[model samples]
Target: MIRIGAVSYLNTKPLICGLRERLSGIGKLSLNLPSRLAQDLAAGRLDVALIPSVEYFRATGYSIVSNAVIGCRGPVWSVRLLSRVPIQQIKRLALDEGSRTSAAMVRVLLSEMHGLSPETIPLAIDQTPETVDADAILVIGDRAMHPEHGVYEEIWDLGDRWCRWTELPFVFAMWVARPGVDTTGLAEILQASRDEGLRSLETIASREAATHGLTNEDLHRYFVENLHFHLGPGERAGLQAFQEKATALGLVDTPKSTL
Candidate 1:
């Protein structure tokens, strides 16, 4: 059986909805944080993974499986930077320890869009923005959706920033596999799973909402409106722009898309 890695975030639920009953006979599912999934896939423990786009640049032999992605065209509720200081006046940022792509995207946005490169420190999982020794802090995943995070006077949603800057959706992650692996029919499998998941979103949202401390309605809206799955023409243009910016900023080595 092919071992595939998927992240356990609320944003990913739609892609994996009804996946077990459907792909169970084909691929083995392994759920973990996005960063860990990236590492395991890179280390050869996984046959394929839904991995951060930046990780594709760091590792070799990763051929992207097209037609699906974790991305946003507008304001993504998660992956935010919170601060009382303005983006220009900020001197330091506490980066999320769990983020690989969002953290890099923050740097890219700051350097390319704002002309600011503040000192950065890793923000611990349990640490609050006020407790961290930085003017601003990047928080991603479910924790970023917390009610308490509203205390921040300035909130910078990275996806919205990217769209406004580049006028294209920002692709956070995509399905990729080792080049030598036999991935025939794999993209079709991934796309089919995504289609099934999208069709059964309400049930998936209801089942997963409470687990993430969000209401069913909230999760449903997040799935249908905030998060985007298709890596079509717009998303591909965005990904290309993002890669160019990341490479130009020296955040990662240049990566060529397989599809």
Candidate 2:
């Protein structure tokens, strides 16, 4: 079996819908957090994995595979900043340790978009986002979509922020495989699965609505409006742009990005 690392999150459900059955003969999938998945891929525990795009730059000998991706044209509801004050006034930023890419993106935005460089603290799984000392909190994944976010004075949608700044979409994750891994025919399966999942989004909404305490309509809209899956030409350009910005900030030491 070809070991594959998959991120366990709602946004990813669409990309992997019916994926196991399709790749049952060639793929053995293991689901984990984005950070762990990246680690597994780097250690050769996985042949391929869907990883935070920033991580693809950390190591060599990998190639991005498939047009399938987790991205947004604008306002991805799940990756956002909840702040008690305007971004410019932020003095301390708490970062959710769940995903490094989102954290780095927020840092880039904080410096380039808002022109503020605050002390950033890593928030543990049990830490509250509304800590007294935190002026802004970068929360990602399903937690960012929670109803409690309404209490924040400012809600900065990072995807929309990226689009506003760059006039391009933002790609959060991509599938990468170790060098020489056979990707032939896999891209078709990956993209096709996303198409199939999107076509049946209502069903997914119905099934997962309660998991996040969202109404079916709310969940359905999230699947339809807040997410974009295809990694087309535009997304590639956005990906390159992101790499350039990330590289510029010294977040990446490689001096160049290949994928």
Candidate 3:
């Protein structure tokens, strides 16, 4: 049976909607934090995963299923950079450990877009907002939704920043499988899953929000309107551009395979 690892985030619910009912007979699926999924995929503990794009560079053999993604063309409110000072004067930045792609994007932006070399520290899971002396802290997923009250003077949306810098969309994550996995079957399954999710978005959003104590309207807006699930040509171009800048900054090793 195939072992699939998925992110346990609101942004990912649509991608996995109805998957439990549809794929139950086919394989075992596990939900995990994004960072844990990356670690498990690296250790060969999972056969497939919806992982952050940057983790693809760390894996030696992996392939992405085409036409599926966790991405956005404009503002993605979930992944943001919260700062206590202006970005230009910030000296240290705390990066969320859950997202390698967003962290890398932040580094690329700091060096290429802002022309600054700020010290970036990885935030620990239990670390409080006051633990770091950094001027800004980068947060992803739920943490980003609610930072410490009054700690941040400005919240820079990463997707908005990318749009301003490149005038292109941003892709945060993609469905990836280990090398030699049945690519055709995996692709078919993922595409079907995405379609199923889109079809029942309302139901998924309502149930998820009720369970989490979030406003259903807010969750619906985030899933259907704010996030774009497909990785089309524009997003692909943006991904390529991001990789180029990351490679130039020596943040990622040269990617041996195409996205």
Please give the CA lDDT of all the candidate structures. Answer: 0.84, 0.85, 0.82
A best-first ranking of the candidates according to their lDDT comes to 2, 1, 3
Compose the digit string of candidate 3's lDDT tens values, residues 79-148. 8888899888889899988788999988888787779878889887677656877899888887677667
TM-score (C-alpha, index-matched) for candidate 3 = 0.93
lDDT score for candidate 1 against the true structure = 0.84
Candidate 2 segments whose C-alpha is farther than 4 A from its true place: 147-151, 255-259
Residue-level error in angstroms, candidate 2, position 25: 2.6
**TM-scores vs. true structure, each candidate:** 0.93, 0.94, 0.93
lDDT tens readout by residue for model 1, 1-259? 8888888888888777666766667878889888889989988899889999888877777888757789999989988988768788879889987779999899998898779989999988777666887888899999888736456668888888989988999989899897677778878878888998899889888998998898999988988888999988898888778777887878877566643
For candidate 2, write residues 102-211 as lDDT tens digits.
98899888889767778988877567776536888888888888737367788989999998899998899999998878878877878888889998899988998898
TM-score of 1: 0.93
* lDDT score of residue 111 within candidate 3: 81
lDDT of 2 at 81: 89
